[model samples]
Target chain A: MTMFTVLEGVAAPLLRENVDTDTVIRIERLVSLEKVDLGHWAFETLRYRKDGSDNPDFVLNQPRYRGARILLAGRNFGCGSSREGAVHAILGMGIRCVIAPSFGDIFFSNCFQNGVLPIVLPQAEIDKLAEEARESAAGGAFAVDLEAQEIRTPGQRTVSFATDPNRRRALLQGLDPIATTLQRDGDIESFQQRDRQARPWIYG
Target chain B: MPGQSLFDKIWDAHVIADLGSGTSLLHIDRHIMHDLGGGRGLRRLSELGHKLRNPELIFATPDHAISTEPGRTSETTPLSSGYMKVLREETKKHGVRLFELGEDGQGIVHVVGPEMGISLPGVTLVCGDSHTCTHGAVGAMAWGIGSSELVHVLATQTMVQAKPKRMRVSFSGRMHDWVRSKDLILYLIGRLGAAAGSGSAVEYAGPAIRALSMEARLSLCNLSIEMGARFGMIAPDDTTFEYLAGRPFAPEGRMWDRAVSHWRTLPSDPDAVFDREESIEVDAIAPQITWGTSPQDVIAVDGIIPDPASAANPSRRHEMELAQRYMGIEPGRPIAGTPVDRVFIGSCTNSRIEDLRDAAAVARGRQVAKNVTAWVVPGSYIVKCQGEAEGLDAVFRAAGFEWREPGCSQCVAANGDVVPPGQRCVSTSNRNFAGRQGPGSRTHLASPAMAAAAAVAGAITDIRQLA
Candidate 1:
């Protein structure tokens, strides 16, 4: 897992509400492509034309937003499916941070596991950032400082954010959750030992 | 201490340790996986050099990638063959049970879990698919997990989860005739918006909910994810017990009695207080259907398509306009009588025996409308067998509906059973998101009876009118 300390790069604004994981990475792309190869296929429907040519109208297809490492989105982004391929595709496309007003519960959790940072901010604040991204000549250069829990926008304004402290620590260190959880194997086994006796049917 | 909700009780029972910042290391009672992630998850665990901690608790089946075609083999869908083969090999190698194609327990993970008694009251279950919340109908703390989380569960039969606030959505009043559980849920999502249940573990209660059959309860809970809730539960009662009594994996004899007694105590106490409380009057909830991309973009079957100008904000109006353009639906026009190219009566949401029976009843002595293709894909092989034994398949077949084999056919469109581009489908599946059925495929989410009615009328018709 790659550590997410600070990310500084171009931000592409996809300001559509309820941008579901299905749209982030279609099920067909997920079934057909490897996780590492999903970048080009992210938002395939919106990114490509019927003739397989790039859709220049797409924000990511524009020269300014090319190779964007940050995504400015609307509420309930990644709202459908538990497909981790959605996060994988985003990461493959070089997006390390997503700023949304809200997120689908599972998609939000998946982002942390893949070293992608999903930040929840007020819709008003996101709208402001997206405005700057759209108007900035420097291609929406933004800095997301995980350690400081703040986002620095192109307009020289600093917007603070909040995240789970434990998750924050893990991301800072790039710790594998399984490895950390395994360190407490003693607790898990003891609980199971007692649980098995109390609920034998569940064990079966 | 305050009275605990059914969700809290089950969650508390599974807590192995409380990790700081409101998170807990919870023991997983059951971890269900499907072909889409099962093989990949196991392989990932091995790549990490981690052994399966509790193989016995894991259940794998090939549903997402396998074809629902008659006499379908693992190789039926060439795209899915590799996944199915990998799942078979990995489950075998890891000592995890695989319900292969044609097997009795083979079905959609959510459907098979409850039917096989793997999902029980007061248990914590997780699966790789979003609809895993369907198992919560059995009074379990069930939710979906991403691939990394799936691999984590594969390596350790537990998950580190943030404790979600409790919410109770009580369906008040008696359901009107022709209103199914699917309608009740769709109505709730449409009314509350898709993000209404975000960050909460929701419990469905009240007389209307208690009156539903176990399969209907499953149908209702299956759409929890669509409403932005990872977990949706209904407390265990006589209905739940009856459904689990003689299942293949349920407890037996004295164990069954003990299990029932325990399950009896799993419901919320009379004084139990939730973080949020909501109630819906079910008596007037007509059969609901979605006309736009999101499940929230829904209305009563008899209602007209919503005009984007009525939206609360510019963004919302823009979204509505985009959805209308993509769906090719004309605003201010009646949604009913809109012709459909296909009708799908299957998915974890409404592919149980009860759902099939409801659709079959509508299809009995009727013929499918010309130019409309309808498919009846059962949730599982057992559901298919049961439907066949009850002559439900014959009724559908006689009505010109194709009675296909089990698996999530045309639901996620991963199995090659997709609605063609630019086609409109009346689907019993949970999601109606753009391209959910296939690229450029417009989906109208509805109940089985409603879908059947649409198939017969060759348009979005109200099931009540047909009756």
Candidate 2:
């Protein structure tokens, strides 16, 4: 059974724009003969220093963001290459909701298909949320409400955002185009049967 | 009082019977596949004990993992031997058309399809790779499908999909010199903030589009996925027809006339309505560059890195800080003159004739910077042959840029050649995400001309300066 909800948790707080899939997760990792704990390598290069030690300067390592679930990212958050491993790593890390100024075209679709809810907010709102996350890091536990489209911090400082109506409907219903299409199984099967009969040379 | 946009016409035409749950079965005409992800789909087919339902409708090629190094003993050694062999074997097993290394059709899957006249106008095309949208330049409805979905398409020759809302992105006015389609796409991705086209298909229209060469149109449509669009397109016009006319698969004689007639009528009716519309003036555009990790983190060539401290939004602040740290950039710093260790000009995005021509123009009399290593790869065998015939290879060689074999080299580091860790590269391919070129290799997405300029300058120099 699939979990019914619009989103889960967000881990990426930095909203750098044009984040291509190749960078989100490197191809080497994809071909690696290693078992992956998605979170273990979530920004593997950034989190690791030159000598393979933890880079204390990285955002994810900061004490304030120790357990942050929501990731706030810049526009085109997933761009470049279309390796789905980027989405897999993010989803595998147990992140459920990603609030971004925008997402790469293919990565956005991959997120929804993998059960991650990608929320888009205005640049201004994104800036505010990141600030709020930073300021309330000491307070511990920043929460986002998908239903209300509001991200609230400990001090009750809230930022509101908007998702595309159609996308929002799809995410909330947990219906990908395939699952949604299967709902019309009868019509599709009939069409398929007709198409096969008409183009018997092409269809099996 | 609503006017129809090109996107709306295509979307409505492709709609099969709608399933009640806000999704429908989309009728696909042509499906393109590449080695990287198609292997899994083929494996799944074997698991199901089913032969491909419609092998003729599908075509597969090896592009992603094929090593760029010439004279390599085999295609398997550089990457995972098992996966590469899987790709080569499955296409044979399924009896789909295969374009291996020795085949003339061999190139980036996106480039191979159109160059061979396989991607026709008004057809719904799907590839296992994301850049399949490149075919949309010829007015085809194309999108990338995942591994599991690829298996579904392989088995059923159809995909269950939700109808996307349509968006018309019209470019008005003339483009300035040095502002190619790559810059225009980067500009759009920057302006619309990447997700602007989410859940929608964008149709490129207006005077600017009609004026572009078919190759330039492909470059523009190729990056639609970067902007969060399922696909992007330009209505089939004379440029598209002319490019397809002499190609191998394109209909000849009277059939050609009929095909053109049908393609001419493929545009959206004036009365058709789009869910959204946006317009841009090419005159206002500039050669663009991506400053941060995402495509939306872009600004004009003369722009500066955005400072998160001064940002108004919380996410922007976080993004700014992260970008600054990851990219080793400081606040309020300009993007120009950023030193680059390497330059790469080739990919599905801008490795065609026009892109090579633009780069060759910059390389004509100039030499590459001694400190910079550059590679210029053609989009396809045809493109490579044409460039060699035109002496673009000599111009590049004279400028100290290595002329590379056609494939997606260094685009995703799928092939062996990648920027060494911590090295910054100016690349003509799309995406400037952190470590995109390789692990710990920083990539800055730029136009081929800009990449050539960077090769000459050994840094991120604006192409306009050279112009």
On the 0 to 100 scale, the lDDT of residue B279 in model 1 is 91
Q: Write the per-residue lDDT of candidate 2 for residues B1-467, one digit (tens) a residue.
A: 67555555555555566544556567677888876787767887888665576677777777777766655323445564555678778887888887777567888888988998888887788987878889999988898876656766777667767667788888989898888888888998888876687778888888998999999999999988878787889899888999998786666777677678878888877776888889989999988887776667777888887778787776567766877677777768788988889999999998988899999999999999988999998887788889999999999999899998888888867668788988888888877767777766777888988889989988788788877
TM agreement with the true structure for every prediction: 0.99, 0.84
Q: Name the regions of candidate 2 deviating beyond 4 angstroms.
A: A1-20, A33-39, A50-81, A95-105, A111-204, B1-4, B48-51, B302-314, B328-336
List model 2's recovered fraction of native interface contacts, to 2 decimals: 0.34
Model 1's i-RMS, to one decimal, reads 0.9
What candidate 1 gets wrong by more than 4 Å, as runs, is: A33-36
Model 1 error, position A113 (Å): 0.6
Tens-digit per-residue lDDT, A91-185, candidate 1: 98999999998899999999999999999999989889988998998676799999999999889999999999999999999998999999999
Alpha carbon deviation, residue B276, candidate 1 (Å): 1.6
Candidate 2 versus the native: TM-score? 0.84
Show the colliding residue pairs in model 1: none
Candidate 2 lDDT score relative to the true structure: 0.76
Best model number under lDDT: 1
User: Per-residue alpha-carbon lDDT of model 1 for B105-161, expressed as tens digits?
Assistant: 899998899999999898899999889889999999999999999999988899999
**Poorest lDDT segment (10 consecutive residues) of candidate 1 chain B:** B71-80
